[model samples]
Target: MKTKPNVLPAHNDCPQTTTTGNSRRRKAHRGIEMLSAMGWWSYAIIIVVCVLGMLFGLYIFGRSGSEASNLTQLATATQRAARTQAGFGTANLNTVLYNAGQIPNGWTYSSGTIYNQWNGTVTVTGKTSYFTITDTGIPSSECISIAQTLAAGGVANYLTVGGTKITPASDIATINTACGNANSSVNSTTKTIVMYVGALQ
Candidate 1:
């Protein structure tokens, strides 16, 4: 006398679950694999390019540094020659030649100091004070010598072969190169340097 459950299509109408084989999904997996391979190659190429660029940049920088050092050494040599000035006297001449406007060794001058004076004379005051000058007038520009005769401060005016006169200039590039952007000039015809070194104190 027990009640029985109804087990027929009308009584249980829910749709049964469906299952698909793994073969149907093969296409999606193949596409993913292809994309991964392309990405790996692209990354490798980018890394190589970056390394090569860095090496090239380093090479350029190294060369520039070497050139800069050479220029610096040349500049220092020029300045020292201009600063450590001493007496300029020939074997027979008794008159010592120097920039007239410069400070006399162990003494001082009152003209406020001048670097470029075209006059034939200078004024100095000291215990051992004496005026010094060389005949700077030249008939042609070809009669000049480039030498440094100073202790070590600025660029030395190249003294004439014989300390007979002072020199002046109009153009800069005939006989010598400029010293590290320092103030350098020469006579128009004689290529004489008008610059001179003096005591600064």
Candidate 2:
């Protein structure tokens, strides 16, 4: 009896997928994570923009007319102040000027030998200064336009006919510009700016 030997099937060598496949898998995972991070960052940016917009809106609305009520009350008090006010006494605004800040450049309180007595309805310009002055000491701490022309950008206290130093209820002081343009006032003396002191309009 001849017995034939059985041949075994050949096993072909195949490429193994371990490190390369793992690295590819890792890269794909990292790409997905990065996209997620980017999306979150975009959302964060949108939120920040919205918050900023709301804050700005609040600021604008808050500034609208909160000061009006206060000014009205102040006006009532000052208008009567003029009635009780006595005649003007002597006080060189210059003496008080130094107590204030430096006198503006190109604008001097106008050096004078005699102190200009602010009597009756005195204007704060020309003989005294080209800059006109309307006294809050007069009525309602009211700003009567100097009618000359100017905007200095500082404050001026009114030494009333009586003796009161009337301050504006609120513009901070009188502005030398005109109230016609925005909310401001001016004097007859051009370039002379008075402080604005009144509640915001």
Candidate 3:
């Protein structure tokens, strides 16, 4: 009898998958862990960049504020210096005018000596002559202009500052040159500004 050996199907030799779902779950867990590690690095980098940006902003703001403060201080100092010089100049002019006898009937005196005897009004030729003094001082263009005009009107004038003779200017150029080196009454040791004027009549 030709009995065929009890043969099964040729595809029955493959291994049976019993825990396929468990394998898939393990693979998914590994992928999540990898993503978590990469996320931690990215978060750290972002925090560092933000902190650096804040620090840089603070540095720039501080530097600009300091510069502005310095400039303000410089401007204040310059303004103070200018005021001081101007005040000193005004005092010098008053002192000189007093000595020249222009403030108190200096025109009445025969001698051209400087005097500090300005007290009250005096009469000359039946008319009471009052000393009319202008408040123009150094660094003022009017001061130079007045002096030049007086000289041209036949009024001989002499002026000195701090023991240095102030040579009268003959031209506009000379006036500019002379005023720069001019000193005030405060610079003098005698505390007196000397100026003598006489009518050349």
| Cα lDDT, all candidates | 0.34, 0.33, 0.37
Model 1: C-alpha RMSD to truth? 18.4
Better of 2 and 3 by TM-score: 2
Q: How high is each candidate's TM-score? A: 0.28, 0.33, 0.30
Instruction: Tell me the tens digit of each residue's lDDT in model 2 across 13-63.
Output: 555556988899999999999999999999999999999999986754432
RMSD of each: 18.4, 13.8, 22.7
- Candidate 3 weakest ten by summed lDDT: 122-131
In the range 124-156, model 3's lDDT, one tens digit per residue, is 110011111111122322234433443343322
Tens digit per residue, CA lDDT, model 1, 12-127 = 58786554555556766888888998899899999999999999877655433432232233233323322234422112111111332222232222344312122222212221
Off by over 4 Å in 1: 1-24, 77-201
Model 1 vs. true fold: TM: 0.28
Total clashing pairs in model 2? 30
The superposed Cα distance between candidate 2 and the true structure at residue 108, in angstroms, equals 20
Error of 3 at 200 (Å): 40
